[model samples]
Target: MLQFRLIVPADLTDEVAELITSTVGATHLTLLKGAALDPVGDLMTCDVAREAADPLLAGLRGLGLEERGLIAVDSVDMSLSRRSDDAERDAPGDGADAVLWDSMAELTEDESTLTVTYLAFLSVATMLAAYGVMLDSSILIVGAMAVGPEFGPLAGICTGLVIRRKQLVARSAKALVVGFLAAMLVTGAFAALLDLFGLFSRSQFERPHPATQFIWQPTADSFVVALLAGIAGVLSLTSAKSGALVGVAISVTTVPAAANAALALSYTAWHEVLGSAWQLALNLAGIVVAGLVTLLVQKWVWHRQRGRAAATSPPAP
Candidate 1:
């Protein structure tokens, strides 16, 4: 269930109450007269099943409550009331499957921004993968993958495309492009510094890495894995199963590929650089393609389900 709190103009309180009363999966409505001193309005609150939250929120916004007042929604981790149970059972779909699009937009918007911390994480993750490449250590490579923050912009791009938010798409693209370029450049310089101390040598880089050779090798399997991971990653985001993101992170070689490319550039290995660049491009393309498809399907399915439910329901007297 989700909790909605709103400060409503005095004249709109009754309309808000009526809307909540009419909504099938809403319960626990409470109103405090003149409760908002700053907004100078009444306070109205309610609990809504996740499956029914989207329309109810849209209705509230359509009524201008959001502009004239304030609206806030929060997840209810635990609800002991029988009304809560009834609300969830009466809702059109399962809570776990619901997609709060406004919430998702806010989340992806914040995550996709080009922030200093984002750069730091990407650069550090790339540097870590460079070390992993030099030592041919699978564990280190996995750790670097898990640490990388590239997934945010990728997801942002997918969400933006589905929602038709061109500005979001542009912002996310900038972040992805600038973030990778900066990380690779920083990693290349770091590799050069390591070479000064004989830590990273051209011979070691040229040597076949039995444990990590695939990082620079583009193959059909790389695209397949990235596609699967992309589907899982978007599902994790929409379903609120965020722990699955760590698995998505470790399953792809995006960070390692960037690291390998950077290291090759530092050592002037033109052939290895091209291979690693291709590997990077293949994985990113696969993820974006898969993610876009997943989001489009979800949006269509949800709308169809709602349409079916509306059709079958009895008409208002």
Candidate 2:
């Protein structure tokens, strides 16, 4: 279940209360009139089924509460109220399957930003992948993939496309491109330093490593794997089942390819660099395409469900 704390203007208190009471999946409503000092409004709180949260939030936003007041939502890990159970049971769909769009937008908005932490993680992941490629260790490659933060920008781009938010698209694109470029450059320098210390060699990269050769080899399978991973990744994010993301992370070769490209550049291996770049581009394109399609399908399904719910609901007095 989702809990909402809303600060509403004094005049709109009755209207807001009526809306919540009429909502099928809302319960445990509480209101403290004139309790909001800063906003000078009433403090209202309620719990709603996850499936019903989106519409309820939309209704509240339509009332201008978001502009004049505050709307904060939190997940209820444990709700002891019988009304909460009833609310969940009466909701249109299962809670886990419901897509809380507002929540998703907020999540992706924060993740897509190019923060210093993001750059640090990406750089470290790329460097780890470079070592993994040199050693031809699948385990290290998977580890690097798990550590990479590329999926955030990918999801952000998909969300922007679905919502038609140009600013989000621009920001996500910039983050992805700049982040990858910066990571690759830093990993390349790291590779050169390792070579100077005799810890890495061009001969290692040129060796026939059957286990890790796939990182620099672009093929149809690369796109297919990335496409499948993209679907799973987006679903995990939308459903809030984050554990599934680890599997998605390891399924794609994005970080490994970028690492391979950087390593090859350090050794002046143009052919390997080109091949790895191709692999990176192919995987990225496939993921973004698949992610966009998955989100679009989800939006369509939810819209249809919302329509059916509205049809069955009784008219307001």
Best by lDDT: 1
Displacement of residue 206 (Cα, Å) in model 2 is 1.4
Worst 10 residues of 2 by lDDT: 93-102
- Cα miss at 141, model 2 (Å)? 0.6
> Which lDDT value does model 1 have at 123?
96
lDDT of each residue in 1-317, candidate 1, tens digit only: 89999999999999999999999899999999999997899998999999899889899999999889998999899999999999888777667767888787778889899999999999999999999999999999999999999889999999999888988889899998999999999999999898999898999888889899999888999999999999999999999899999999998989999999999988888888999999999989999999999999988888888777778877877
lDDT of candidate 1 at residue 167, scale 0 to 100 = 85
Go through the candidates in order and give each one's C-alpha lDDT.
0.92, 0.90
Quote each prediction's TM-score: 0.96, 0.96
lDDT of residue 121 for candidate 1: 97
